[model samples]
Each structure stands twice: as structure tokens, then as C-alpha cells.
Target chain A: MPLTKRIIPCLDVKDGKVVKGTAFVNLRDMGDPVALAARYAAQGADELLFLDITATIQERKIFLSLIKSVARQVNIPFTVGGGISSEADAYNLLSAGADKISVNSAAVKEPALVSKLAKRFGSQCVVLAADAGMQADGNWQVYVNGGRKNTGISVLCWIEQAVQMGAGEILLTSINNDGGRKGFALSLLQEVTARVQVPVIASGGAGSLQHFADVFEQTGADAALAAGIFHEESITIPQVKQYLYKQKIPVRL
Target chain B: MKLVIVDYSAGNTCSVIFALNRLGIAPVISADAAEIRAADKVILPGVGAAGSAMLSLQQNGLDNVLRSLQQPMLGICLGMQLLCTASDEDDASCLDILGGQVQKLDAPKIPHIGWNDVYDLRGDLFKGLPENSYLYFVHSYGVPVSRATIATAAYGQSFSAAVQKDNFYGVQFHPEKSGDNGLLILKNFLNL
Candidate 1:
């Protein structure tokens, strides 16, 4: 049987509570991390992505504790990202209860960091998250540091490199479309999925269930991720899944 | 039932533990042969390369102990691959409790990661699970359908999704993370 497309709910945590931001800019508080996580899992979310917006040393400790508590409450695989620049950082998060460690800016700085984490803990444990924005030339450029720094690296080149370095999954978030509530960058998602063998999770503009269906149908992404809509309860995971199933998309009902 | 999850340095046993905990069964995660042999049921859970998994099992002397287990045992993902005769991943020889060998998937994707439907169910391990029900899978290698095969799934090709011979059972998917379908399968195994 073919693998079903996945619907992932992203939680951006600042301090200790989950937050939501627009295009990686203004942040707004959502709710408690553990409570929100339990809700999503019970709602039948395929997977969860936790991005530590503020990875301060103090916040890091709180985040790990949050992970420990959430792990007990949620019974699905979850990926954690933000400030995972070293193997030790990855180890700490994994031991704390993250199934996968997503590397972004740090990985672009040291491409070997991907291989290092993959070697220590199987490739399946490493997730390559790339923040990209479409350029005037119609090419997506990689961004770093929460979309504040443009690395000038081609998105395709970076994805190919990370996959070669042993990243098992790719989390492609379109900076332009992120928080716009328009729709996903279908062209960019298609480009990444075509270039990499690893599963590509499309993140960014997800205004409605139709937007998700469009991304899944137009692109080869294995999953679609959203934060604002899910956090605000504007759209529930079960609603999105039911929509996908009705659209003839294979979703776990 | 007394449940023991065989732990041979395999990664991500927490999900399995949590799944069981939800059902009110506090299972022990141990590599101890004595505890495993004495358990009413055993779950051989693993993740990572087959070579390293085999080496770790042999190093801990759990390889032979796993083979001698008389109770109903379930192997998951890498655990399932390890129960076969051998695997193409690093050309590692595994515990031959079940007939057939594990080979790398010829799919366009190397690691078949995500949820997929498994059909042709034929064992108590899949009791109450509808045919073509979805389950989570994450692996690069898998065993081909053989005489012991009770279920099969199609990726780039047909492969053994679940297998059983005597009291030995193996599933290529992660029932722990497969949501309700997974919970039901684990419940079936526990009932067995």
C-alpha cells in the first residue's frame, strides 16, 4: 500500500507557552504546550513539530521539561527544532522525548552537523528544516535565523546537500507564504520534493483545508504543516483530515 | 500479563512504553535475558542500522537469548528485520527464528517513512484491524513475503508487512505510533 499524506500541526514555543508568529515576525501567545499537544494528538494529528522560537539556556531547560511531560501525554512521533546546532543538543532533545531533531541555520553553517547527528543517532532521527523565500528570479533562496538572514544559497542545492549528508526528512517552510494565510508555495514544494528522496513536509501559508488539498495535489510533498490555523482553532486537525479524505486523499480517519 | 520490551540499545522504545501505559500495562524495558525469558510476553523493539543492532544484541548476549524465547514475542521495524535470517543492510546476519531474508527496498525512496496500509491480514496480531488499515512504517530494508508471512504491504514492491511462525511474530510497521489502528494491534498482541 502507498504511504498516506500526513497532516502536521506545528507549535512555536516561546518562554514556555506555545506561540504563533507572522512570517517569523510578531509573535503571539497560544496556550500551554502540553495541554495543546494532548489536544492535537487526540484530534488525530499525524505528527507534531515543536519549534523553540526562543532557545535561551533558561528556556531550553523549560522546553525539555515540557517535552518530557508532553511525551507522556502524547503517543505519536514529534520533531523538535530551533538551536539544535550540536550533537549534544540533539542528544539532549532526543533523550528528553523528541523523536526527531530538525536542523536549520546551524546545518547551513556546518553541513557536517547533519551527518554527525545522523551517524550518532540513525538518519531517521534527523530532520532538515529549510526556510525559503521566492526571489525575483523565480528561484527560492534559503534564509536563516528565523528568516532574518538570507544565506543566498539555492533551496534545491541546500536540500540536496542536507539529504546527502543524511537528513531523513525535509521541513520546507516558505517564508513569503508563512503566516500569510494565502496558500503554500506549490512551485517551491514541488521543486524540493522532486529533488529529494526524503519525505518533504510543506509548511507556511495554510489558510484553509482547500489550501492543504491544493498543496498535496499540486506538489509531491509527503505532508503539510500549519501553526496559526491549528493553534487558533480556526481549523481542527480532524476537519482538515476529513476534508482530505473527501478529496480522495488517503488520510487516516 | 507480564510484559517485557527487549531493549538492546534500540532507539525509541518510549512510544511503545507509552502505548502500553495507556492500556494500563507498565512494561519493563530490559536487555536482561532472565527477565525476558521469565516474562509472559516480550516485545523486541529496535531502530537503527541492522549491523549495529545485531552487534549490540550479540555484545549484550541477548541474541541467543532472544532466539530461545518460548513465550509469544513480537518484533517491530528493525526488531522485525532482526528476526529474519539476514538483512542486506550492512549484510548483517540476524536471528533466524522466521524463514526468509530481509532485503533493502527497491523503492524510489530509501527509508519508507510514514503511514501505509497493510492488507491480507492472517494472524491474531492483527485481530479487529480492518484489511487495508493504515499503520506507520520507517525503515530502509524489509523481508520478502514467505511461508511465515501473514500480511503484505506494497511500497515500490510487495514486502512482508507482518509475519508469524509458531509463537514468533514480527511487523514491519510501528504499531506504537500508528494511532488507533496501532493501539488495536498491540491490544490484540497483548491478548494473545
Candidate 2:
């Protein structure tokens, strides 16, 4: 079989606990990050991503501890993101046991950090997490700081530049579709996946198994990421993979 | 078993150590030639460009030490590529324990990340695992299927997912991060 499409369950973490919010607000405590990670691994999650929603310099130690604990138990690969502004932060997380470290607002502020991280670590270790929302002109604009500030930069152009700077993978979350559970932003994902050669992970707006299938079929996204759906137990990773398998979408089972 | 994960600072050693710890084996992470040579089983875990990884291995004199080891040595990902004669990633010469050249993957996507099935299993490394068992992979370069290849996986084309020659074995997939089946592969290697 070819490379199977990944089904990643994201854990939006705050302080040291796992939390989920709608469109990145009104957060609800899910559970312990380590416990949730073990559950996902047992359920055959392809990978896990922990987004430190409220990452502060003071909380770095807490987040690093969480990563170390998760790495000790969870056998699958996991990535830690949010507020990683420097090479030291990225290195600390990787050393703490994260398979990859994602950069977002930090990379937008310092594009050279992407290249530096990629050169120091391999491209495979750097993931560019882009949060984009549609603009009035019908173009997607890049948003940072948890989608509060719009950079007025075209999503396509920013993604292209980041990839050139050596980002190995693209984790694209449609700010409008996120936490809505309507469905993935197919058009945005389609455009980005088509433009990039690296694997594109579609995030946000995953309501059902059909939503997962649609994103994989309609767009060139290599993976689909959802937090609320899995956290709520509305649909499980195994269920999604089985559904995709029936749809003839290659998924690891 | 006294397992030692050869750490040349190539990355991902912590994951490997944690994986082994889950299996009840506390592997010693070391670059010292003596410690690695003394271990019953040695694992060479790597995650980075071949050129720099090779450079680190040589700088620590691990290249010669690894080439001379007689224990069951297993290489994962970039570590696997380094077991080959050479790699096209940085045009670096490898340990040549295995008979092949690591070349860039000829696929639409450069780094083929995610789970893929490994079939055509041939050695004790896959002892209890079924054919077409899924394993996680993340790399831009891979060693094409050759005489030493014990199992094969396809991205754009079939490449060596696992290879074995005498006491040395190499797998392009990251068993440390490949979930249960991956841990089984590591357990199998440990048993060997």
C-alpha cells in the first residue's frame, strides 16, 4: 500500500492540562494531557500534537515536563507547538521527547528562525503551523497569536516562503472552520496542498467521518487533524480510519 | 539485555530510550565506543541529514567502532541510511555495512511521513509480525531495495523498509514511534 493518510488528534493544552475551545476560546478542561495521549495512542492515532494555547515563558517548564511524561508512555510520535520562539525552545522540546516542534507566530515574526531550525535539525523536525482566515477580497489572510491578529499576508505566499525556508510539513488550520465542526475548509486546503510538495495536514471543521473523507478526497491533504471531535468522542480515530478505508482512502488500520 | 542506543547527537535518542523503557529495558544512551561495544544489543538511532549525522559519528569515532561491532546492531531512519555504502543526501560516505546506496526518494512528496505497510519480510527482525504490517516513516531519502533488504515499502517506488546482513540490521521506519507493531520490531531485535 502507499503511504496511509494520517489521522492526528490534537490536544490544545493550557498551563499543563488538555483543553479545547471553540474557535480558540471559552476553553473547557478535557483531562490530563498524558492520559489523553495514552488513550489516543491506544486508539491507533497516527500522531498526536499538543498546542500550548497559553504558552508563557514561565509555563515552558510545565509544558516540557508534560512532554517528557507523555513521551515516556505514548509509543507513537507526537509534536509540541505554540510559543516556540527560538532555537533553544525548539531544542528543549525535542530533547524533552517531542518528535517534532511546530512554529507559528514566532516564525511569522522571524522567518529566519525557520531556516535556522531546519538547518540545525532536519527539515522533518520543523512543522509550520499556519492559521488562516478568509478575507473580504476572497483571499485567505494569515492570522497569528491564536488567530487574534491578521498579518494581512496572503496564506499562499506565506506558506510558499516558509517551505522555501525549510519547513518539512504544513499544519494548516482554517480559523473560520476551526471548532465549528461543519466540515474542513476544502477550497483553502485544496489550494495549499496543490501549491506545496510537502505533506499538508488539514485542520479544523471535522464534524463526521464523511467530513474526514471529504477533506482527503477533495483536497491533496496528506492528513486531517481534529481536536473537539475526538475529545468529545463523537467519532474515534479507528472509526475514521475504517470509514476512510471503505471509501478507498488509504489509512493505517 | 544490556542494550545501548548509539547517540552521536543525531536526534531522537530520547524517544528510542523511552520506547525501550516501556518494554522494561533501560537502554544506555552513549557515544563511547567501549560502552556500545559491551552491550548485548546496540541500536543506532538517528534523525537528521546524512552528511551531518555521518560527520558526528566520525567525530566521535563511532563510524569505525560501529563498522567493527559484532553484536546485533540495528539502525533506524537516518541511522539505517548510514549503514549503506553512501548517501545522496549530502554526498556522504556511509559505514558500508550493508550493500546499497541511500538515494533521494523519487516521489511527488519529498519526506514521506506517516504510516505505511512493510511487506516481503525476511528475517527474525519481523519474527511474529504479519506481512504488510504498518510502520511510521518520516524521511526525504531512502535506500532502494537491494540484496540486503529483508522487507520493502513503497512511497513513489519500493524502497528498503528493513535490511539485514549477518549481525547488522537496519530499518528506515522509526520503530520507536510506530506504535505497538514498531515496539514488537524492537523487541524482536532485542531478542536477537
User: Which candidate achieves the best TM-score against the true structure?
Assistant: 2
Model 2: per-residue Cα lDDT over B1-192, one tens digit each? 899989888876899998898889998889899999999999998888899999999899999999999999999998899999999989999999886889999999878999999999998999999999999999999998988999999999999998888999999999999998999999999888
Q: Against the true two-chain complex, what DockQ does each candidate achieve?
A: 0.63, 0.86
DockQ of 2: 0.86
Fnat of each candidate = 0.57, 0.81
Provide the lDDT at A41 for model 2. 93
* Best prediction by DockQ: 2
Residue B79 displacement in candidate 1 (angstroms): 0.4
Q: Write the per-residue lDDT of candidate 2 for residues A62-175, one digit (tens) a residue.
A: 888999999999989898899999999998999999999999999999999999999998999899999999998789999999999999999999999999999999999999
lDDT of 1 by residue, B1-192 (tens): 799998887777777888899888999988888999999999998878889999999999999999998899999989998998888888899998886779988888767878888999997888888899988888878899888898899899999999998989999988887778889989999999
Alpha-carbon deviation at B89 in model 1, angstroms: 0.7
Every candidate's lDDT: 0.89, 0.92
Candidate 1 ranges beyond 4 A from true positions? none
